[model samples]
Target chain A: MAQLTYREAIARGIAQEMRRDESVVFLGEDIAAAGGVFKGTVGLLEEFGPVRVRDTPISEQAILGAAMGAAMTGLRPIAEIMFADFFAVCWDIVVNEIAKSRYMTNGQMTFPLVIRSGNGGGLRFGAQHSQSVENWAMMVPGLKVVVPSTPLDVIGLMAASIRDNDPVIFLEEKALYATKGEVPDGDVVDTLGSAKVLRQGSNATLIALGNMVPRAQLAAEELASAGIDCTVVDVRSLVPLDTQTILREVSATGRMFTVEENPRLCGWGGELASIVADEIFYDLDGPIVRITTPHIPLPAADALEDLAIPSVTRIVETVQKSMNS
Target chain B: MSLDVVAPLLLDDKLDLYRSQFALRQFEKRAYDLFLENYVKGTSHLSIGQEAIAAGVARAMRPDDWTFATYRGHAHTLARGVPMAPVFAELMGRANGLMAGKGGSMHLTSVEHGVMGSYAIIGAHLPIACGAAWSAQYRGTDQVAVCFFGDGSTNIGAFHEALNFAAIWKLPVIFFCENNLWMEYTRTTEVTAVANPAADRASAYGLESIIVDGNDADEVYAVTAACVARARAGEGPSMIEAKTYRHGGHSRADPGKYRPDEEVAEWLAKDPIPRYHQRLLAEGASEAQLVEIERAVNEAVDVATEEAKAGAVPGEDLLMKDVWANGGAEWRN
Candidate 1:
C-alpha cells in the first residue's frame, strides 16, 4: 500500500487512464505546461504530448463545450473549470446539453466526460473563489455528481467517472487536495451510487458529504468517548442519491443528523431531510436534525468564515440535540 | 503520387446535392400542409426557401459525421438521411418520433443518424456541436461535426464560446451560418457590426472561412464541401457563411409583415429550389424526368402526412421517463 495524497492520487488515476486509452485527453486553464491550478494534473503533459494535454483559454463555457464535443465523437475528455465558483458561467452547457444528451437522444449518445474543479472554503479564498456549487448540479436531473473526501476515494471515484457513460461532476475540496491517506494498489473501480458507513453505531446516523465527511468521523469518534454510539455515513454521489443506504441506517439507529457546509435554505441537506421524512418518517425516533451554515452570504472575515462552516463540535451538538428530542 | 483530397461536391454534381434540396423543399411543403391542419403541433420554422444551404452542407459530410441545428432543422435532418417518418412523427408529437415525442418541432433528434438534435434555444446548439466535434476527434475518427445556426445566433455569447473552443482545440467542425438576412423581425446588419458574420468572426479565431451566395446551390455545395473535407482530414475547423434569404415567415403563425413588398418579390425570384431546378434542366435533366421527380416528391409528402396522422400521441406517464439517464426518481428508489 502506498501513502498518496488526494492530489497525487487524482494525477496518477488520470495518467493511468490516459496511458490505457489514447482518446483520454484533458483541457483546462493551466493544466498543461503549468501542471494544474491544484497540481492534480501534474506531470500529465510531460507523459502525454501537448496534443492531448491542452491548456485552454479563460472560458469555462468553452472548456466544457469542447470537452463535451470531444466526448461525443469518441474521446474521453477530462475538463477542469479552475474553481467551482466559475461553474456558474458554464451551467447552460452542464445542465442542458451534457446532462440531458443521453436521455434526450433515447440513450443513443454517451457523454463519457469528467468535469473536475476545486471548491475552496476554509483556505480563505473569499466569496468569488470559495463556494460549493455541487448542490446546484445535484438539483439537475441528468448529472452524476461526486464529492470525494479522501485520497483513496478521489482515485477510485475519478477512475469510475472516466468510464461511466453519464456526465460526472467531480468536486475536489481545495483544502483536502494535499491530505494524505493510504490508496491501495490494483483495480480501483468504485460504484457511483453508494454511501460508505465510516463508523457503525446504535444511537444515531450522521450523514455528510465531501469535506464534511472527515468532520462527521471526528464527531463520531468524540461521541464514542462519551458513550454515544454515532454511525457516520459518507454520501459519495449526490444526484442519484443512495437513499436506500440512508434509510437502512436511519431505520436501524432510529435517529438521523445531516451535516453540510452549504447554506440551510434549498441546500443539499434540505433535500436529504425531505427524502428521509418522505421515506423513513415512521422509523425516526426524533426530528431529523441538520447541522449547516446559516442562510447568509459566506463571511469574508477569518473568524467568521471559520465559524460559517460546520465544525465537529457543531455536528456533535446537533446529534446531541436529536438524541435529547 | 500525392494523395489527392476528394474535392468538395460541385454544383455540377447535380444528383448528390440536387436530390437533397429537392427532398427538403418537398418535406417543407408537406410539413406546412400538416402544420396547417393541426397535424404537427408547436411552432414550425419551415425551411421552404432556405433549403440549399442545409442540403449542400450536409451532402458534403460523411455518414458517421455529426450535426446540430436550429429549430429550422428539417432540411438538415432530411439531408442527413434520418427517416422522414420519424421526423414528421416527432413534429406531430407522436410516440414514434425521433425523440419519442419528448422533443417537438424545435427539438428533433436522431443520434443514430448522427444528428445530435435540433435546439430552439437560439445559439445554444453551437457549444453542443463543438462538443460533438471534440468527441469525434478524440476517438481518432475521421468523422466531423457540422453546426447550422441562423444569422440571429451570431449575436449570442454562446457563438463566441463555441468558436473559441473549436479554434483552440483544432476540433473537426464546420460552423455553417445561414444568413437569411433577417432575425425574426430585425435584419442582420441592424444587429451585427461585422460585415460578414461567420467569416469575419472566423478570422478573429485564426480559422479559414468564406461567404457564398446561398441561393446558388453550386457555390454553397462547393464551399461546404471544402470545409467538410478539411475537417475530416484533421486540418481543423472552418466557418462557412451562406448568404441566403427566407421566403416564408420566421415561424408557422407569423406573416412576413416586416419585409418590403419589392424585397419579398426579389427574393422569391431567386428561390433556391427554382434556381437549382433550372440548373438541373440545363444539365440534361429532361422535363419529363423532372416532372416524375416532382410527382414522387408530392407523393412522398402525402405518404408522410398519412403516417403522421396515424401515429400514436405520447402518453402522460412518459412525461418524466427520459429526464434521467437511469429511470429517474422511480428507478433510484
Candidate 2:
C-alpha cells in the first residue's frame, strides 16, 4: 500500500477502469487534453486516444444528457461536472431523465454511468464554486451517492462506482484532494453503502462525510485526550446510509455529534441527526449534537469562509457540549 | 436532388413498394377508427398522410439495424416490422402489449424488433439513436440506427448536438426528419430560416443530405435504402428530409385549425395511400386483389382490438415491479 493523495487515487481509479474496459470513456469540460481542471484525468488522453478521453462543450446539460444517452446504449461513460454547484443546471437530465428512466421503462434499461464531481466548501472559491450538495442527490431514488474522505476510500469507492450498474453520483470534496493516505493498489474495489468506523469508542459517536471525516477523526482523538472516548464513522455512501451500524453505535454511546461542511439549514448532518433522534431517541443520554457551517453562502474571504465551515475545533466543542448536556 | 450514385439495392418493381405504402395507410386509418371508438386506451398520432415516409425508410433497414421515433410513430414502428397485433395491443394499453402496457402510445419499444423506442419528448431520441449507433459499431455489428424526428425538432439543441456527435464519431446513423410543415400549431416557416432543414444543416456537419417526396413511398424507400447502405459500408452518417404532412391533429384534442384550409385540402387530395393504390393499379394489380388486401388488414386490426380489450390489466401489486433489472432495493446506494 503506497501513499497517494485523494486526487491521485481518483485519477488512478479512472485510469484503471478505462484500461480494463474499451467501452469506458471520459467526458467533461476539460477532462481530455487539459487533463481536467483538477488533473484527475491526467495523462488519460495519451494512454487512451481522444475518442475515449472526450472533452465536451461547456453545457453541463449536454455533457450529462449525452453521457446518460451513451450509458443507456451500452457504453460506460464517466462524466465529470466541474463542481457540484453546476448540477443545478442539469438537474432535469439528472432527476427527471437519468434517475427515472430505468424505473419508468420498467427495467428495460440500466444506466451504468458515473457522474463524478468536486463538492464541499473550502479553498475560498466563493458561493458558486464552494458548496456541499450531497443532500440534494440523496433525495433522488434511483441514484447512488458516494462520498470518499480519504485517498484509499476515493480509489476504492470510484472503482466500485464505475463497475456499479446504476447511476452513481461520486462526489469528491475539492478540499480533500491534496490530502494523502495509503491507497491499496490493484483492484481496490469495495462495497457501496458500507460505512467505516475510523476510530472506535464508547462514550460518544461522531459521524462525518467527505472532508469532514478527517476532521471528525481528529476531533475524536482530541476528545479521547479529554477523556471523552468518541467513535468516528465515515459515511461513504449517503443514500444507502449504514443506518444499522450508526444505530448500534449511537445506542452504545447514547450521545452523537454529526459534522458536515454544507450550511446547517438543510445539511447532511441534519439527516443523520434526525435519523438518530427518530430511531434511537430513548437510547440517548444527551441530545444529538451537530457541527455544521452557518446557513449562508460561502464567503470569499478566508477567515469568513473558515467560519462558514465546520472545523475540528467546532466538532470538539460540539462533542464536549453534547457530553456535558 | 439525386446524387446520381450507384444504388445498393435496385427496385425494378415499384409496384411491390407501393403495396407496402397502401398497407401502412390502411393500417393507420383502421387504427384511428378503433381509437375513435374508444377501444384504444391511449391517443395515437396517426400517420394517415405520412405512410410513404415510414414504409420507405423502414423497408431499407435490416432486422439488426435500430429505429426510433417520436409520438407520431405508428408508421415507423409498423414499417420496422413490429407485428400489427402487438402494435395495436400496445396502443390499446393491453398487458400483452410490446412493453406489456408499461409504455402506452407515446412510448412504444421492442428490442426484439430493433425498434429502440419512441419518445414523447421532441428531439430527445436523436442523441439516444447516436448512442445506439455507437454501441452497434463498438460491438462490430454492421447495424445502423435511424432516428426520426419532426421539422420542429431542428430548433432544439438535442438535434444539433446529436448530429455533431454522430458526425464526429462517424457513427452509423441516419437522421431522418419528417418535415411535415407543422409543429402542432406552428409552421416550419415561422421557426427556421433555411428552406430545407435536413440538407441545409448537413453541409454544416460534413454529411450528405437527401430530400425526398415523403408522400411517395417508393421515393422514400429508394432514398433510405441508398443511405442505409452507405452507412453500413462504413461511410459515416447521412440525413434524409422527408417532406410530408400530418393529416390529423398533433395529438387527440387539438383541432389543427392553424393550418390553411387550401393547404390541408391539397395534402389530403394527394393522400399517400390512394396515390400508392393508384400506382399499384397502374402497375397491373387487379381491383379484387387490392380489395382483398384491404379486407385482410381490416380483419387483422379487428382481431387485435378484440384481443387487447379481452386482455387483463397489469396488477396493482405489480406497480413497483421491474423498477430495476435485479430485485435490488428501489433506492441506489
Candidate 3:
C-alpha cells in the first residue's frame, strides 16, 4: 500500500488507465499545462502527451458533446467540468444526448465516458462554485453516479468508472483533495453499487455520501464516546445505490440517519430515506432523519456557509435525536 | 444566375442523381400523405425542396466517410443508401425500424451505413461531427466527417466552438450548412447578424468557405467533392453554404402563411427535379426513360410502405431493455 492524497490517487488512477488503454484520453480547460486548478490531473500532459491529455477551450457543451462523439467512435474520454455547479450550462448535452444515446439507439452504441467534477461546499466558493448536484445526475436513468469520500475509494472507483461500459458521473469532493490516506499499491477496482461500512456499531445506522462520509465518521466517534454507538456507511454510488447494504444495516440497527451536503428537498438523502421507509418500515425503531443543507443557495459568508452545509455536529445531533426517539 | 453555368453531367450520373432526388421527393410526399391519413404518428419535418443537397452531398461522399444530419433527415439518410422500408418503419414506430422504434423521426442512426445520427436539437451535433473527425485523425485514418445543419445553427455557440476546434486540430471535417432562408417560422435574416453566415464565420475559424446553389444537384456535388478532397488531403475543415429553400411548412401543422407568396413562388420555380429533367431531355435522353425511373420509384415506395405497416410494434419488454449495454445489472436485483 502507498499513502497518497485524494487528488494524487485520482490522478494516479487516470494515469494507470491511460497506460492500460491507448484509447483513454483526458480533456478539459487548463487540465494540461495547469494540471487542473485543483491539481487533480497534474503531470498527465507531460506523461501522456497533448494527444491524450488535451486542454480544451472553455466550452463545457462542446467538451461533453465531443466526448460523446468520441465515445461513439473509439475513445474513452474522461471530461472534467471545472465544477459541479457548471453542469447547468451543459445539462442538455449530458441529460438529453450522453445519457440517452445508449438507450435511444437500442444498445447499438456504448458510452464509456467519465465526467469528473469537483463537488460539495467547504472552500467558501459561494453559490456558483460550492454546490453539490449529484442528485441532478442521479435522477437521470442511464447514468451511473459515484461520489468517493476517501483516497482508497477514489482510486478504486475512478478506475472502475473509466473501465465500465457506461457513462459515469464521478463526483470528487473539493474539500477532500489534500486529505491523505493509505491506497492500495496497484489496480484497485471497486464494485459500482456497493457501499462500504467504515465503522460498525449497533445503536443506529449513519449513512453518508461524498464528503459527508468523513463528517459521519467524526460524528460516529463522538457518539461512541457518549455510549451511543452508530454504524457509518459510505454510500459510494448513488444511482446504482447499494440498497441491500443499507437495508441490512438498517435491519441490524433499528435507527437510520442520512447525511448529505445538497439541499434537503428532493435530494439524494430524501431518496435514501424514502427507500428505507418503504422497504424496512417494520424494522425501523424510529422515524428516518436526514441531515442536509437547507433549501437555500450557499452564501459567500463563512458563518452562513457553515450553517448552510451539513457538519459532524449536525449529524451527531440528528443521530442522537433518532436514537432517543 | 442562369442554369447554363452548371457543368454538363454524364448521362449515367445525371440519371442516378435524378432518380435519387425523385425518390426522396416521392418518399416525403408519401410520408406526408400517410401522416395526414393518420397512419403515421408524431410530427415530421420534411425536406421537400431541399432534396438536391442531400442527393448531391451523398453522391460526393465515399462510403467510408461519416455523415451527421439534422432532424429534417429523411432525405439525408435515404440518399446515403438507407432503404425506404426501415425509414418508413422508424417513422411509424415499428419494431423493424432503424433504431427499433426507440428513435423516432428526429433521431435515426445507422453506423454500418456511416450515417452517424440525426440530432433533434439544433447546433448540437456540430461538435459531435468534429469529434468523429478527430477520432479519425487520431487513429491515422484518411476518413472524413460531414455535418449537415441549417443556417440558423451557425449562430449558436456549438457551431463556433466546433469549427474553431477543428481548425486548430486540423481535423478532416466538412460543415455543410443548408441555408434554406428560414429557421422554423422566422426568416434567417431577421434573427442572424450576417448576410452570409457560413462565409462570414469561416474566416474567423481559419476555414475555407464556399457558396453553392443548393437547388442545383450538379453544383452542390461539385462543391462538396472539392471540400471532401481538401479534407482528405489534410487541409483541415471547410464550410460549404448551400443556399436552398424548403417548399413546405416547418412541420406538418403550419400552412406556411409566414412566407410571402412571391418568395415561395420564386424558389418553387427553381424546383430541382423538373429543371434537371428538362436538362436531361435537352441532352437527348428519351422521356420514356424518365417515366420508367419514376414508375420504379413509385413501386418501391409502395412496397416499402406496405412492409412498414406490416412490421410489428415493439413489445412491452423492449421498454426495459438497452438502457445500458450491461443490462443495468447494478440497478436491478
Model 2 Cα shift for residue A63 (angstroms): 3.8
DockQ of 1: 0.48
- List TM-score (chain A only) for every prediction: 0.97, 0.97, 0.98
- Model 3 chain B worst lDDT run, 10 consecutive residues: B1-10
- List residue ranges in candidate 1 displaced over 4 A: B1-12, B315-333
User: Model 3 segments beyond 4 Å from truth?
Assistant: B1-9, B328-332
Ranked candidates, highest lDDT first: 3, 1, 2
Model 2: runs farther than 4 Å from truth? A59-62, A263-278, A286-297, B1-44
Mind giving the per-residue lDDT tens digits that candidate 3 earns over A1-325?
A: 8889999988898998898999998899999999999999999999999988899888888788888888888889899999999999888788988888887777778889999999988999999999999999999988999999999888889989999889999999998999999976768877888999999999899899988899999999999998899999999999788898999998899888888889878888788888888889999988888898999999988999988898888888877766766
Q: What TM value does model 2 have?
A: 0.90
Q: How close is every model to the real structure, measured as TM-score?
A: 0.94, 0.90, 0.97
Identify the CAPRI category of the predicted complex in candidate 2: acceptable
**What digit string (tens of lDDT, one per residue) describes model 2 on residues B1-333?**
443443533333454566566667766776777778886765778787888888878778888888888888877887777777777777776677776677778777776788777788777778778777876776678988999999999888777877887887788899999999998888887778798877798889898667889998777877888788778977888899989998888877776888889999999988888887787777677778778767777677678667766777766645676554463555422
> What would the per-residue lDDT of candidate 3 be over residues B1-333, giving only the tens digit for each residue?
123423446888989999999999999999999898887799899999999999999988889889999999999999999999999999999998888898888888888888999998889899889888988887888899999999889888888888888888888999999999988889998988889888777888876657899999989888888778878888888899999999999988887899999999999999999998999899878999999999999999999999999999999877888888685434723
Per-residue lDDT value at A131 in model 3: 92
- Between 1 and 2, whose TM-score is larger? 1
* A88-116: candidate 1 lDDT, tens digit per residue: 88888898778776666666667788999
> Tens digits of per-residue lDDT for model 1 on B1-333?
111344644434675576678888888888888888888787899888898888877767777888888888888888888878888888888888887777778777777788887877777778778877776776677788889998888998889988888887788888889988899988888879887877888888897668888888777766777777788888888888888888888999878799998999998999988787787788777777667777877778778767776888788766777554454433254
